[model samples]
Target: MTTEITIELDINGRSETLTLDPRVTLLDALREHLGLTGTKKGCDQGQCGACTVHVDGARVLSCLTLAAQAAGRPVTTIEGLSAPGGELHPVQAAFLEHDAFQCGYCTPGQIMSAVACIREGHAGSDEEIREYMAGNLCRCGAYPHIVAAVRQAAEMAS
Candidate 1:
């Protein structure tokens, strides 16, 4: 027998109701069920921040978050970072300008975490940004460009 739970997700200023398996992780529900593939799945064990998303304005690893726990909470993924029609968020634009990523596998998580880092007043310096973003690992070793991008985004945001 299959058991399903109804969840209301306030995603990107929109409310969506979905019936999902209680065992489903928020990452799987977003990617597989909701088709929000922008939130990548790397190291599904939560060691990697590839599945990062904003829950109630705070960055959380979606891979470790249960879908049921996110009900009625605001969940923002990369797809919701910018306005519709592909307007890049300032951080995203800065990342592009700085060439902050290579394979882009971890870019989504990096950007998500960066946004939160800046919002939480943790982007005051490169060292601070690096320390705050330490959870999101980029295998490309693009820390320099990533730091540059975050700094630029912080300037733009301010």
Candidate 2:
């Protein structure tokens, strides 16, 4: 018999408790158990940035992290990126304004990573932004737009 563990994840500014299989990845817990499908399942192997999310305000690949590992930690999904009243986060606004996404499958993770890249002070230069955001691969070749949006967002935040 598989042992199920109860984990309380603070997601999107709210506490959501669930009794889940210990082997379930945080990505599955967020998308399957909690219905927070904004974080895509592109690779499911952590190679693609489609499953990225913010854990404790840092970018994390949910596909590689177990649900139990996220217990008691604050998790933020794309849905949480906006203000409660529906105001977009600076990165989100910039992404939209600059059309940073094509095909739209990788937008969530790209945006999440962009936010962290800027917060970590790596958005100072285009080269730095590319270096920091290298982990998030955009198959649609939207790197130019992505970099532009990230740079714009970083500037707006300063």
Candidate 3:
């Protein structure tokens, strides 16, 4: 018989208890089990940053992170970035102002990473922003605009 473990996760400031197989990834737990689908799954091997989410304020790959491993930790998905009053996060706003996305498939990951990039103090220069955001792939060639958005958001934060 397969063993199922019940774990409680703090997601978006809410407590969610799930009973699932240990193999279930945090992506599946958020998208499949909890109905929070903002965190996309791409290049499930972790090469692409599409499945990025913040665990305890640090970004991580949900695709490779087992749900159980996140138990007792705070998980913030794309949906959690917005304020309860419906205001967009600074990075989200900057992306809109800069038109930093095209197909939008990678925008969530990019935004998530950009937030971390700014918070981590790595958005000082264009080169630094590019280096910090290298992990996120934007097939639409929105790198220039993305860098601009990150730059703007970083400036706003400072």
Candidate 4:
């Protein structure tokens, strides 16, 4: 037996209506239903920030966010972070320039979180950026570069 519900999400500046099982997390709905695979599934328990996404301009763990909980809210994934014409967000450009990722599995989430960290004014210093971004783990030990990327993006955004 299964129960399903419909939800309307404004993802990445696009509006999408999805019918999903109640148990379907926002991550599954985005990756499975919408084919937005940039948001990785890591430590599905929400301990890892791999599934980070912005819900109404605030960062959230998609793995633990229920699809229904996101209904009628603007959801922004890694795919939605840039302009339509492939214009990289400042954070994205900084990440690329700094080579903040090694394995790359955690890049999307890290980028997403980095954007939020700057927006939330938590990236004012290296230690602040590190603390705010601690949730997003890089298995390849790229923390230094990640911090540098956030710092660079923050400086550029100012």
The C-alpha RMSD in Å for every predicted model, in order, reads 1.1, 0.8, 0.7, 0.7
C-alpha-based local distance difference test score of model 1: 0.93
> What lDDT does each candidate get?
0.93, 0.93, 0.95, 0.93
Sliding window of 10 residues with minimal summed lDDT for model 4: 1-10
If scored against the real structure, what TM-score would every candidate get?
A: 0.96, 0.97, 0.98, 0.98
Worst 10 residues of 3 by lDDT: 36-45
Q: Write the per-residue lDDT of candidate 2 for residues 45-141, one digit (tens) a residue.
A: 8788988999999999999999999988899999999988999999999999999988999999999999999999999999999999998988999
Candidate 4 whole-model C-alpha lDDT, 0 to 1: 0.93
Per-residue lDDT over 1-158 for candidate 1, one digit per residue giving the tens place of the 0 to 100 score: 77888988888888889888899999999999989999999999989899999999999999999989999888999999986888989999999999999999999999999999999999989999999999999998999999999998997888
lDDT digits (tens) for residues 5-64 of candidate 3: 999999999999999999999999999999998888889989999999999999989999
lDDT over C-alpha atoms for residue 78 of model 1: 95
Give stretches of model 2 more than 4 Å off.
Answer: none
